[model samples]
Target: MSLASQRAGLSRLPLRAAAFVVLTCVAILGVSGWREWAARDAVLKGAETEMANVARSLTQHAEDSLDLLDSGVVGVVSRLEMDGTGPSTIAKLGKVLEARKTAVARIHSLAIIDDQGNWLTSPGTIASTLSDDTFFRHHQLSPKRDAYVGHPVKSVLDGQSVVTLSRRFNKPDGSFGGVVLATISAGYLSHFYEQFEIGRNSSVALVHGDGLIIARNPNNERFVGRSVADAPLFRDPSLQRPSGAYRFKSPLDGAQRVSFFKRSGRYPLLVLATVDQDELLAPWRAAAISRMLYVVALVMLIAIIGAVLVRQLQRGQRMAAALVEKEAHFRLLAEGSSDMVTRIGLDERLRYVSPSSNRVVGWRPNQLIGTDALAGIHPEDRPHVQAIVDAMKRGDMDEARLTYRNVHRQKSEVWLESTMRVTRKDNGTVDGVVAISRDITEQKNLETRLETLAIEDSLTGLANRRRFDERLKEEWARAYRDRSSLGLLMIDVDHFKSYNDEYGHPAGDACLRVVAKVIAAEVQRTGDLAARYGGEEFAMLLPNTDAAGCARVGERIRSAVHDAGLVHASNPAACVTLSVGGAACRPAFERTAGTDSLVEAADQALYAAKDGGRDRLMMSGEVTTLLPKASGQ
Candidate 1:
């Protein structure tokens, strides 16, 4: 034991000591990670279980409310319909509804409009004026024994959102008379969602089947009645899931957020939940970053100590001492890293797992180390995931990304995003991949929102021009493929200019929206499209429709507009009516005939309608001479 030997031994001691400390730290991290993971897994599992229960609770509550409303409404409407549409009937029904004010008041006003565009009974004197209103036409179109629920429309009596429910009534002897009606207020239905509790920086809203935001918590006043057509949450194909979380941009603050949706089955209601991104990732991010920082600090300290120790050591003993110390330091670093650093086998199973394994999967590193990683993937997504791995093996991709739902220890589905990079040999051959994943349900939501804004219309809530264009092209292609006719109807609100002149621009805007809704309802075929072409005008594309079908649809739209009866001093054909021009033709792709031709023909016919005295439907062949015969024919 000479001086050199002592120096070598001292250096070896430090190396062994550092290695032991690093290994101990690594084991601690692995154990801590496992423990934390198990706890989080439990919490998430409980949350999922609770969510299902909550959904059931919400469903039950909503069902009770609906049933109560239905029962009360049926009694009143049945009495009103059984009696004649006389003043006595009106007085009796009004008194009955007023007596049941507690229930009826929960909604907006309740009234009965006849099939001939006349109010049979109502809340007040305003009913007399609505006698010739547009809703009457809707009642006429609705069949006997069936109810027609109009889209959200503003009540002329009160400036509020309302859904007009009407059932056609006829004498037992088979004579057509009128309809029984009920108007549901915005406040009544919106109150249901207002009671929900989402996490902080989160929101819950109710959207219509057509993708319009009818109600929302926190900002219902601002966003309610506003259309999210331009929002990615509305238009993206991926966002169509019935109940799942994705990303969205806050309409108020424009911040990216996670959004979850549950589409209502019975009612045209859609529930959405939104949450901020950073809020969800904060804990995991902090833990991962802190661990990396610790590793960096330890590496720096070890490097400095190694340099200093080498300088102090005599030359002859340095090499042997350095080798031993380095091996120990390397081992310590490997064992001490915070992440569950492991060497995977060729079979894609866990050959090694750090103590941190328990933190990630609710199982200790030892428990999972020998198991196949594929076992953790959700059964539904497993095949696709394995396919991606296989592609990676074949050098089809340098790296791959995946987000999958996995069942945790508590049996809760957790969304996970994974990034895997394949390790390669010097010969460029495939080696096992190192995959790292983190929960990113919120991130995916934001991306989904971005995609929605690109597809939907911002106003009128009908599909935007681009979306309409795409749908039109698709419909046209289908019609051509099947050798069926495609019908195009172009509608212009007659004397809209005069309506705007007599009423304010706000009134004009309101009139247009109401008209747009009427058109939407009238064109109810699954493949039909109703879109705002531009200012005061709308377009419809009907697939598999012939000339007669297009004509009937056009007449229904014309009649509905006339029924709305929004006042206009300049129009000769009653209060604000619509003039529609339609064209139906089997498409020919090789003939170079574009959609513009149909639009042009329809527009030309519309001009003829205006020239012939507005509020009529004109087909491509008919000229202004026929407008008079078509008017109220």
Candidate 2:
């Protein structure tokens, strides 16, 4: 009986050994294949990151160049605004333009065009009309006065290609006056693109949001100014985002590329940087092939020692059981934990969702698994969230924290602040991401409400001092840039202390509210600001307004208060009256002083008004003008 059983077992030994060898070889191939796949993924992600950084660098450089051109153009525009485009001014402007163009190395030419697009002056030898140019047509048709960056075109004066950054100037009556054009040579930008060290078939370019290739590296003139409007990247809704990256076949050359693009927040400019996928993965492919060959050799060696792996087979089963138990423990903790935990793949699909998702975002675990992680994200916030995820996937960061809005299953928008960690494979390459998000809607709302109250005056419903100071600083910078005037008016309730003592505090507050209302109503311009500076005193900020305009507004306020007819028996006028003072100054680019000087001068004028009489408006000596005394005075 024993001889038969032993013979049967001995016969099955070779078959069992053969099966072990085959299974071991298959396992080695599978693991090696997965590692090679991860290596390729790493290569692609690294290439994308490199492209993104290059795109960002190019974008910043472009913005700096455009900004330099803008400053030069703004000065010329201001001159044309202050002084008409008469022959004398044009002759002087031509010389000024030549000097400026020489001083600014980036500018190829500077010219002033008439309202009809007649070139009034050109730094080039030949003056030419730009009546049919895109820039001229844009300024003529659109009332917007912001700087416009036009497509590449051959300059009529020099017969060379150039990109024009133009601005529209206005007449004294705010009518369309003309355009100030600053030209940047295309050749110079091409030279600037030469510094990048991208490999073969790679490109760096400046693209317009409308899909015009404004400029490109590798010195491809044929690609410049070409329309790529129908390209996948341009057609995608992501074009509206400030910055993003995409991988697609080039519509121009049909080359596959992992193109990274960054869009300018201020201009219609796009900086594109790309790397040829095949070239970028060349090294990875070589290494992967060699590693697979090694795996094949190791499989043959394992086949000879198949019997020796019996003990390892038993150990592997034990380890697998332990891992299964550990995974179950993790699930238990995830389900019981208060915070919602999720694992998201690079495709933005949820790999794992915890039970707490129901309590967190009003979705069950089953409802979220295998669904797009971004489906619940707010439309406006998805771009930023996607960028953060991309950065982690690209190995730029190991952990990230962000706050975003999520649409709850109940149809409510809830703010969620999440802390995310990049999950990695054993090869140290990225796997996906693990994120823990908690509801922050309540905290965010409270913070927003508190911020609003911080800058508002509760008593008079006007801007408080903090807000006034902040706005004045910004307006001062704007006025300094445009070389325009900034006016400030200080108003004080005449005999306010006496009125408060006689009529009680409540009545005094009511009077202040009424005064604030009058000040706000009188200063109604888009750039105007009326603030309750402090108790019983208010301030009005008028940008782009001259001294006479400020005095007129001050007079209106005083006369309106006098007409209000609020009784004040303790005062000499027997009614509430305002002592108003106004001062204006054309902000100078050469000045180093801040807006504090303007406020101090206006305050001095208000004291003068109060000293002369209780209810009168006084103008500072910046301009020789003063309104007639108010009726109460």
Candidate 3:
């Protein structure tokens, strides 16, 4: 234990301590790297799972959309078969197609083609024949009644790409008659796919079983009808399941992505959801690098300060973990939301828009940022929306609920119900508005359809008796207030009962519809109302008309019905004809008379016309007397 021996030992202690610290730092770095790798792998797996879920959801949506179109086509085919392909039947079919086209925004057109590919009924007259079309040929040859979804084709009418949903119709003898086709715009599918909040360079696509890209987000018109059959995704034996995930470089975009695909159970369509490999791994990589740097810093501090900094390092780690968790939670809530979350500056510009903006208005968050918040509002609704914003700015209302029309990027109108709260500073100064908006377009459309159904006749597409009564009362009041004459014409089909017996109930319905159209045509004024009063009976109310004008309109209606030339072997005229009765009056003020008197007068005139001879018009006199026959004797 001399001084030399003691000094050597003390110097060795420092070297030994440095070696031990180096080993400890290496071990810590190894463990930290391993943990980061594991976490990164888990994040990637989670991303794949999320993509799979998105793919499944999009597949189901696409299947549902196709099924809806298929069902509508089938219904039209069934209806056409039940009622033959005569002119009247074709007219009815056209009406059905028109209604379906309006109700379904995705449906570009609903058409019926004959066996020879002639357009039997369509939204508009297009001379193009479907004889060369694959869908038509498939139905013409195949006996299967399954609806066939055709590949994308440029529509001759609008030159836009469309996929056809078609059902084959057979004749009574079970022979192929024609195909009832519904064209769905490919843009609609693209718009739907754009709603998903997949990361940057991500893709959502719908492809045919044959690998034709039917529709895709980030849609390129050139690649839509192209085939990807040779691509690894389709060619890979391991990725053939009904639903699956795979990693591949996209042939179209050349970006490497982890893609999830789902095949529709009901159709030959496949939906793909994908995320770029780099994008998906970006956050985890950044977090890993940050953790690595923090670990290195911790190691340096340990070497310098021994174990004193360990507790502080642990505390920092915990705080960092908590921040990461909070960020993840925030992203989860924000991205998963279906309702759009928005921050609007006091300048009426969009400060921040959530990913859900894509779903609600078909606009990306970036596309909306810094744009005028009220720019997309419908012109008619802008004033109201501005008023609401003004109220919030004035501090009169801290929160408001507003429903307004937002013009979608596709030029369609979407109704959004927004709940907005004014964000205020501590000093009570307005900061901005925070809002949550939900798309209510479908709900609004449903309400509109219900309202239409309530007031429209299902058979003739005219006003029903209820609607007629409502309008009659309204017009009557208006005419009374203005001291103007109101005209009423009661029309009945001649020999309708016999027509039914001879031509069957369906033909009778057809005849009645035609006669109703004729009556409707005769009363073309803005305030005129023509309605199916009852079975085989129709009524027309024309405001600001005298007895002479009423008689002239009645004559026009009778002639039009006769000119329709709807064959009626039972009637003496050898065709479908209408018997008309007319009445005109200037209603007096209270306690003078009721609308019943006008109706009774018209009824009496109608009996006189029928009694004199069918197919004629008779006018009611001023004193409720029946005047001579006007015309159509």
Candidate 4:
């Protein structure tokens, strides 16, 4: 019965072992290849997030620079229009301009140019007709009244590359009197981008909405002021989005890149943060190759181990010890990995845990074995984690990855991420589950910080315009749903330009900071938000507030600033004061309804307060206000 049959079975072992080795290699290749793809996706997403962060930071820098220029130019224009165009007035203004240029290092030049090709500050530029200048023509012809930013040009006085930011003033008779011109060094602005640590071949740029490159990092002087109108960033679909990210091949160097672009809120400007795709993926590519090589070695090791097991089976007595040795060999493989590995039984108890648990989660492998698998996870995250495990046990899923929090450890939060797979018996029925986990607290903290930076203003440490816009939209929807009142206060520092003019920009900054603190201290409600709206302007948004209540809050903020007693020589009150205007309304839900009317009304009242002597509060709405009725009432 035995000799021939045993001989045939022994002969078939080589073919069976070869088949098993091939199948194991195929499975390893499939799983490892999927992981490689996921790694690439993670690398690309990280680049996208980094580019977004850099773009936002550059946008803020550009905004602050423009604000500084606006403050100086506006102050000069106001003084010239009111003080008259006499020779004495022109002489006095010229001296003031020279002083400002000296005080602020960033200001290349500041001048008042007449309608007739004459420069009040510089006698040399008189021969060069200022009347034909792009900035001059913009102010002379366009009545838009906002500050105008012209293309970069070589300064006539010194041949330095400069960008002109100008505003026009009118005579009391409504005649075009002259233009206030301020130039800032384009090099200074572009150089600000060099501090970022983006890869070598990567670049950053500031582009006009009309597709002009105002400045660029990794700078070439020849590239400044060049038009990139046909670049992917300025193309049709890209232009349609205010801010977005995309992948494209650069026309300048033909390098593929992952780039992010954002448009500035108040200006026709955009910021581009481009990352070179090759450099971005270099580390990931190297790691991926290493991993595939490791998989190949692992497959060969498994085949050799299986052949030895078959040899032990032939001897019959050594089979039991060989199986135990194989288990230990696989354990060594798990321990060599960076993650903490664990195996769970159907009873949801840990059957085995890798030694790396001590490093990853501060728990020894022996201490975790036989314990409930979900016990260490936070209560809120346990249910979902268990659901994933159960689904895998039922063959509904073969693999899953999840991130969750751990139960309190020593006095700090711990975030953990897990990649899990279903373990099966030779009969193909699910036995239990196997998992790999690693601590991800650092990553979680970094993400939180990035989110905060996106919303908060770096200078004043207050809610920035972006945060305010997001909150405004959210509050608007809530107000509409409840038929509740939303109150808004528009606060502007009174005669701020004159203050900047008298004390210089540094003192002006300190004065604004003091006022900002005073305004912030008045809004005590969790729902009320106070934001730095823009240069010298602050806003307080009060939800469920009536016009009277909003006016009271404005009065408190005004009184606080007055009490702070920061001196402002140019202000009529002899102190820094605020012109505050409040508007409140019960929102009626409609598809097209928005906060535009409320903003407009508050703005009108703000202008009225400014015209009616500076330091006062004005409220916009009926004295007898009607409230939305509740169903019971």
Off by over 4 Å in 2: 1-23, 123-132, 157-159, 238-240, 300-633
lDDT of each: 0.66, 0.84, 0.82, 0.81
Give a tens-digit lDDT track for model 2, residues 1-633.
Answer: 233234435545556766878887899989999999998998888888888899898889888989999998899899999998999998998898888888877788888888986778853532552223888889999999899999887666655567789999998999899999887777677778888888788988888778888788876577787899898677777655766768899888888898788988888888889989999989999988998998989987887677566556555545544433435766787778888999998787998899889988999999899999888899899999999998998989999999999998885889998999998765678878999989888899999989989999999888999999999999999999999999999999999999989999999999998999888898677889999998898999999998899999999999999999999998788899999988898766326456876787788799999999869998886532221121111
Sliding window of 10 residues with minimal summed lDDT for model 1: 623-632
lDDT of 1: 0.66
TM-score for candidate 4, residues paired by index: 0.47
- The lDDT leader among the candidates is 2
What TM-score does each of the candidates earn? 0.39, 0.45, 0.47, 0.47
What's the CA error at residue 413 for candidate 4, in Å?
Answer: 2.0
Give the Cα-based TM-score of candidate 2 against the true structure. Answer: 0.45
Using alpha carbons, what is the TM-score of model 1? 0.39
Q: Encode model 3's per-residue lDDT on 119-151: one tens digit a residue.
A: 887536334522238888999999999989888
Q: Give the per-residue lDDT of model 4 (tens digit) for 44-114.
A: 99999999999999998888888898998899989988997788988888888888888887887778888
Number of clashes recorded per candidate = 21, 0, 0, 0
lDDT of 2: 0.84
What would you estimate as the lDDT of candidate 4? 0.81
Q: How far is candidate 1 from the true structure (C-alpha RMSD, Å)?
A: 31.2
